[model samples]
Structure formats: structure tokens, C-alpha cells
Target: MTEDFYCDEVLSDKIQVRKVLETDNVLAYYHTKPFWPVHVVAIPKKHIPSLITLEESDNELLLELLRVIKKVATMVTEENGACRVITNLGDYQDSKHLHWHIVSGEPLKQLFNERLQ
Candidate 1:
């Protein structure tokens, strides 16, 4: 991640990220930028540096994250009739925390990449 990119670079607070839901190891919230018709971010509150840095202790968190992904997926599909999901890491990662970018409908990759770049 670049020095200019970090957790704070994006939405800073729980309030900044629209109220969605929070599980034990993950915080699922609406993305400030709706890349797709249905967009949300399932992020771990833990200050994890990146995906590769995730530890064995993160297994539970990982599992919960996946579960949140499923829930979000269902909700988006049923409510918005859109289907898409995204998560970046390493050079593509801007935030220090582990966050799953869940999206649906429309092509958002190009714009997202461009803006982040």
C-alpha cells in the first residue's frame, strides 16, 4: 500500500461506513462508493496489514468473513438483482485492514482502479 493509502484514506469511522451489520470478526457495511448497484464492504476491525499477513488466529475471522460475504451476496442478489464481489491485496490493497469489497451490477473495476491509482 502506498503511504497515501491506508484505512484512514477511505471511510474513517463506523459511522462513515453506512450501518450494515457487525459479526464477531467482521464488520459488514455499505460502501461509500457504490461501485455496483449493490456494493458493500465486509471489513475486519483488526488492523491487519494485508491479506498475506493474516495469521492462523485469523481463521475464525476468515470464516466469519466468508459467512458475511454469503449473507451480503444473498441480500444483494435478492434485493438488487446484482451479483459482484471484490477484495484487493498487496499492491492492489489500499487499506491496512482486511476488507472484502462486495459489489453487484455494472462494471466497476476500471473506475475503481483508476480512482485508486
Candidate 2:
């Protein structure tokens, strides 16, 4: 897999995603493999390395992406009562792409199952 899973898979259509919202510059969808009960991912359709890498020229694109994220976040929060918006950075980031996760409820996967035992 590439460092940018979003570009290599999701954007490339190698992995299909169920879309939640879409705009000319943004795409929001249900995570292919959800980590939470209510999990959605919002990303710019165009490939952006990461949030911190965005340049001043990308202001409009950034605004559009944020609008989509806000819409998705509101939907999740209204339906689930609460939600969390998250974005990883640097080494903590699994995929080196500008993506935001709008999630609700406790984790569905036992990601640290082995470590806890």
C-alpha cells in the first residue's frame, strides 16, 4: 500500500466507499472499514498531501472541504447525540493525506486488544 491510502485506494477507486456527501471539491463517505459505530470520512477530491502542507493558494479548496466536513459532522451529531472530529498528523497519521474523520460512539474494533491482554 502507498503512504497515501486515500489517493491510492479511495480516490483511485481501487477501494469503493459509500458516499455520504459530495461536492465539486470535496467528498464525504462512510469509512470503508469503520472503526466506530458511526464513522464518516471527509476529504478533498483533489489529492492534498496533508493539512499542514496546504498552501495559501488552496484557501478556497480548504473552505469547501471544511463545509462538507461541517455538514457531515452535524448530521452525525444530530443522529448520534455526539461525535468526534479527528485528524492525525506526522507519524501518528496512518495515511499521509488530508482527511478528517467524523465519528461517534465507542470504538467498534478492538484495535488494542492484543496490547490490553
Q: On residues 1-117, what C-alpha lDDT tens digit does candidate 1 reach at each position?
A: 344232564434524656577776577887766666567888776667767888999888788888988888888888877677777877787665777877776657766787898
Q: Give per-residue lDDT, candidate 2, residue 88.
A: 82
- Taken over the whole model, the C-alpha lDDT of each candidate is 0.72, 0.90
lDDT score, candidate 2, position 83: 96
Model 2 alpha-carbon miss at residue 17, Å = 0.8
Residues 1-117 of candidate 2: C-alpha lDDT, one tens digit per residue = 879888899888998899999998898999988999898999898888888999999999999999998999899999989999999889888888899999998887665574587
Candidate 1 contains a number of clashing pairs equal to 0
Using alpha carbons, what is the TM-score of model 2?
Answer: 0.90
Can you give the lDDT of residue 7 in candidate 1?
Answer: 52
Show pairs that collide, candidate 1: none
